[model samples]
Target: MLRLILIGLLLLVIFPVLASAAKVMSADNSHWSTARRDSTGIAPDPKTTPEAVVQVYAARAFNWRGIFGVHSWIAVKPEKAESFTRYEVEGWGVSSGRESVRIGSYRPPDAYWFGNYPELLVDIRGAEAAALIPQIAAAANSYPYRDRYTIWPGPNSNSFVAHVARNVPGLRLDLPPTAIGKDYRTDGIFGVAPSNTGLQLSLFGLAGVTLALEEGVEVNLLGLTVGIDILTPAIKLPGIGRIGFPQGPS
Candidate 1:
């Protein structure tokens, strides 16, 4: 059986909500912008920070209920979209930090929308600047996914899917493949869009038992998503080795 490993890092920002609601102007542009004057009521300050960019999209990501709802803001100093995208977005951000994380799909086109939104309609969604201060301060400097590369970290089935995609062309595959490994204690937080209440899950060890968890977001299955964070002993399994590859290139 193939193991699957999919990862998403939801950098939860504790930002204050704007008094007004904003619509995403474009459904195609990945890099969005707001004019100096707009109804969203955001200030056009010369100081443009990552938290500022994050503030622009927080309302949208929380309002919509899928991966499409989540967006990225490439950082810039004394920010302007042109200089920002050229110097920072395409350059440093793509290769380092959370910006380095890939969705396995939606490759951004030249300074434009990569996943779903278009350029003309990519307006900024307003957020309270005060709420973002803490989250910005808490963000660490390490690469996002680097934290997950550890000992006995859950089923992480998507790893097998990638291996099969690369090594076994024309070979049919199946979902919910068999898995085996010792279980460990784990902690996680889950929530649906537009809801304040979050469900917390804690798992105790004894591997090979596949536990089913909801994707959390209540939108259509087209954007299905789920996560399992595990903490187990550094034991080796007979079938699944430590971070083993499924019949793929070494």
Candidate 2:
């Protein structure tokens, strides 16, 4: 068993390092201030659609951070609303007393994260979206980490999204393995998975195991996660995320 665990740990470190090296070679070296933040046309226009919509998005984090993980956020558009509201936790300005939880319609709902294109993780529309919008808003507002931000382990952007996902199970959000802070548990070491479909035991997000219908089996080590998705047939890696099949709401 010890040999097996050692082998697993070696694989976890080696694979993510290889993936990160590849990402570095092909990375966009643009400065964050000048990086593209335009919309990718993935979101339905609020004026034209007029239907309630809820979406979860993840994008490679800016600069070198992109090589390791992604930043996740949630956006919502209510029926007949002319704009979408986005909820995300950002580390910027936290030391200056600004809250980490940012809620507004400042940018395009589907805008790129710096230079990284955003991938839609979950999409819900019509009546279902309308019903869940309030709950999502409440979850965002009630997030305990609004005043705190930690890039590794717990209570960062991914943690914020995970909290919202756990509260709104209808989302069935399957955050990718690259969402590094997703396993951070605010309530305790034991809690429901972000998908709310199974259980997870995490030690303040540093290390843990997650098993769920949506997330499959993920082992978190030192804030990095490696796993296999049985339901979707994918191998979840640290830096490169899932390989084999795409995951999203049906």
Model 2: per-residue lDDT, tens digit, 98-212? 9999999999999999988999999999999999999999988889987799888768999999999989888889898989899997678998999999999999889899989
Please report the candidate that would top lDDT against the real structure.
Answer: 2
Alpha-carbon RMSD of each model = 19.0, 1.5
* Cα TM-score per model: 0.25, 0.96
Q: Candidate 2, which ten residues in sequence have the lowest lDDT sum?
A: 16-25
RMSD of 1: 19.0
lDDT values of the candidates? 0.22, 0.90
Which sections of candidate 2 miss by over 4 Å?
1-7
Any runs in candidate 1 off by more than 4 Å, and if so which?
A: 1-54, 58-111, 115-131, 140-144, 147-196, 200-250
